[model samples]
Target: MTILLVEDDEVDVMNVKRAFKKNNISNPLVVASNGIEALEVLRSVSPDRPRPKIVLLDLNMPRMGGIEFLKEIRQDPELSSLSVFVMTTSNEDSDKIEAFNLNVAGYILKPLSMDRFISAVSTLNSYWTLCEFPG
Candidate 1:
C-alpha cells in the first residue's frame, strides 16, 4: 500500500524516510509539507502518482493543520474512507479526542528517538499489511 506522509518539518520528514528504509518498507511513499499540498496530491489525476492507502498526518502545520484536514477529508465522499493515522508531538487530550472523532485509524505521538521512531513505523508497516483496502 502507498503511504502519504504529511509533515512540515524537514528533520521529521527525513526521519520518516530513514525509518522506512530501516524497516525495508518498499511501498511507494508520497510527501506533502502541509494539508493543502496533501489535498492537491490526493486529488491529482496523474496516473503516475499513485493514490495512498493510508496517510500519516501531523497535527501542527502552516495553512491548514491536521484537525482541519481531518475535517475536510472526513466530510468528502470521495476521500472519507481513506485511513489516516495522526503522528504528532501534541499530547493534548483534546487533540486526541478530536482526531478520534474524525475517525482516524490510529493516533501516534512522535517519538523523540530514532530507534523509537523506527519501531513505531515498523509496527505501522505490520498493521497495514494485515488490512484489506477497498478498491
Candidate 2:
C-alpha cells in the first residue's frame, strides 16, 4: 500500500520514516511538505497507479493547512472517498472535533518516544495490510 505523509517538519518526517523502516513497512512512501503539494500529488493519481491507500496528515502547515486540505478533498467528486488521518501534535479539543467533523479516518497525537512511534507505525501498517479496500 502506498502511504502519503503530509507534514512540514523535516525532523518529524525523518522520524516517521525511521519508524516505518523499523516496523518493516516497505510500501513506497510519498511525502508532501504542505497541503498544496499534497493536493497536487492526489490530483495526479491515475487508473494506471492506484491512489494512496492512506494519508497521514499534519494540521499545522505553511500554506494550506490540513483542515483546508480535507475540505478540498470533500468538495472534489473524484477524491471524496480518499481516507485521511490527522497525526499531529495539536492536542486541542477543537482540532480533534473539527477533524472528526471533516470525516477523518483517525486523529493520532504524535508519539514523542521512538519506541512508541515505531509501535504506532507498526499498528498502522498492520491495519492497512489487513483492512479490505472498497471496490
Candidate 3:
C-alpha cells in the first residue's frame, strides 16, 4: 500500500525519504506540501493510484495545518476512516490531546537526531507491516 506524507518543510521530507530507504520500506511514498494539497490528492484516487493506507502528517504549514486537516477529514464520511499518524515537531500536550480527540492512529514526535529519526521510522515500518489495512 502507498503511504502519504504531508509535510511542508523540504528538509523534513528529505529526512523521511532517507529513513524509508534505510529501513528498506518499499511502499510508494506520496508527498503533499500542505493539508490542502493532501486532501486534493486523497480525493483524486483512481484505480491506477489507490488511496494511501496511512498518512504521516506534520502539524505546522503555510496554507493548512495538520489539525485542520484531521478535523476536515473526520467530518467527511468518505475520508473519516482514513488512518492518520501525526509525525510532527510539536510535543505540547494540547496538540497530542486534540490529535487523539480527532481519532488519529498515533502521534509521533520528530526526533532531533538522524539516528533516532531512522529508528522511529523503522519501528513504524514494522508496525504497518504487521497490521492489516482495509482496501
lDDT for each residue of candidate 3 in 3-121, tens digit (9 for 90 to 100): 99999999999999999999999999999999999999899989999989799999988799999999999998888988899999899999999999999989988866999989988
| C-alpha RMSD of each candidate structure in angstroms | 0.9, 1.4, 0.9
User: Cα deviation of 129 in candidate 2 (Å)?
Assistant: 1.2
Note the residue pairs that clash in candidate 3.
none
- What value does the lDDT take at residue 80 in candidate 2? 83
Question: What TM-score number comes out for model 1?
Answer: 0.96
- Candidate 3 — which residues are off by over 4 angstroms? none
Per model, state how many residue pairs clash.
0, 0, 0
Distance (Å) between predicted and true CA of 112, model 2? 2.1
What's model 1's overall lDDT?
A: 0.92
Model 2's lDDT to the true fold?
Answer: 0.88
Candidate 1, 24: how far from true, in Å? 0.1
Q: Write the per-residue lDDT of candidate 2 for residues 1-135, one digit (tens) a residue.
A: 678999999999999899988988889889999999998888897787667768999999999999999989889988788778899999999999989998998888985688888888888888788888776
> What is the lDDT, from 0 to 100, of the residue 127 in candidate 2?
77
Please tell me which model should have the higher TM-score, number 2 or number 3: 3
